[model samples]
Target: MQSTDVTQRFLFDNADARGQLVSLELAYREVLAKHDYPEPIRALLGEMLAASVLLSTAIKFDGLLILQARSSGPLSTLMVECSSDQELRGIARYADDITGDDLTDLMPDGVLAITIDPDDGQRYQGIVPLEGGTLAGALEGYFANSEQLPTQFRLVADGRVARGFMLQSLPPDRQTDPEQRAATWEHLSILANTLSAEELISLDNQTVLRRLYHEEDIRLFDSGPVIFKCSCSAERSGNAIVSLGREDALALLDERGGEVAVDCQFCNASYRFDRDALEELFEAAEERARGLH
Candidate 1:
């Protein structure tokens, strides 16, 4: 049975702990649809995508989880993002002659940056050193240092799918059952580590969960849909131009044959804005400002 890109949260009824089973099939392919990434880079994207989704389910925030990294070596930047809704997207920037062996080595001394942005409040971001450790290790370190939780995660991204599984102790204040938390998290992780890329990319959610935790009493919640969507459009891109001011906006139009092209790096979706498009967008802003005055 084939599984869709489904992220299911499970709560140990009496164990006082929580977990998530995430399997990405078509969703992973959607992310890699148009991008050409090396094997290692593809694997990294898978890890980050799953990590981002895990973070979304673990935390109670309503916003975005962005995983970004920059290296001083060959692979300049690698990024992946997942939202509270389980929507995921990511890409890797590499040179034409990059090899799998060279890709992991490329970020020997880079920095891993994770940003948590809420829709109704200020955004917070954390950065950690990427010292020879994999993306999962770096994020685990982030949780230890920031949230101080005993978190175990397995992130897998293959050519066909990217999925991640996570187990974490409930906050002491939330449950106040230390023994229960330990037993639950430990048992779930013991089984979770057995997951393979083939299983994650192909099996159905129910089948995958049964294979890992058939005997456990887990309450599966509503799965938020996950998809490959670009939040870019001509109106939004032109608003960016308006922020840059009318002079710069006209300059861009002249530079790009009377139309400005705004491309989203994640999905590679382009939004084109010509003179008239820019004029309307700028006019709306001006009118709003005038009304405020």
Candidate 2:
């Protein structure tokens, strides 16, 4: 079992299907260390993080891919974001008594939203009901309903390691025979279903693929590293405070004993601003406003 974090992309030479395998060890540990999340929430967040990376690899965007789940049960919200550069961050909000193991038990009447935010273009979001027993099932349902494609996902996380595997059918243009395509997809999906949770979290990408598809000719591409990185900063946090208007910012500053602090939910990093810093930030914001006018 390698300790490095990586995502590998591969294709079946004999079928019109492509896949991605992601293993997260250090990144998983870093994310878990940021907060004292309960066992179930930690596992859920790990799955969401791995799923975000796996889904992001399928797109050609230059920004972020976010996986968000909101519900009316004990687990209120779970959010994970993975950038095109493979940087990832995630957080979850839940009640103190949340002890459910199944997705429905934790997030009853939940909705899963997948958002693609490109750096240069309009953002796209797809929403679907979280209907499956597990996170992987909900994601597969999303692909079937929204993308009109057959997709399969297997995700496992035990607080120490998080791993995910995704297999998606290619577009119709890629295959001439529809029956053959369907057969190939079913065959590969059945083989993938045989993967155990322990193997997914413990084995390397090459060994996993070989064990799953030993009879097939698969083309494995270069692997990319996945890192745990929070995009929050003092400047961004200050801008957020500036959005609250001058009077409100000043009131917060005064309430906090001359310093306002903003804590990032993902990484728990604190950004503080004193009265002088707030004044300077507001002055610069006003200057930008005047320039716009």
Best by lDDT: 2
The lDDT, on a scale of 0 to 1, for candidate 2 is 0.91
Give the alpha carbon lDDT tens digit for every residue of 1-293 in model 2: 55479999999887789999999989989999998998888888999999999999977799999999999899999999999999999999998888788688899899999999999999999998888678899999988988888999999999988999999998865567988778878899999999999998888889999999999999999998999999999999999999999999899888889999999999999999999999999999999999998
**Which one wins on TM-score?**
2
Q: Per-residue CA lDDT of candidate 1, range 1-293, in tens?
A: 43477788877676656777676767777778868777777777777777878888887889888888998766778887788887777888876776545335877668998898899898989898875367777777878888888777767776667777777766665446667656666777778778876786677666877888788777878776677666667677767788989888899789889988888777788888889988888899999999998
How well does model 1 score by local distance difference test?
A: 0.76
- TM-scores, one per candidate: 0.87, 0.95
For model 2, what is the error of residue 148's alpha carbon versus the real structure, in angstroms, after optimal superposition? 1.3
Error of 2 at 184 (Å): 1.2
Clash count list over all predictions: 0, 0
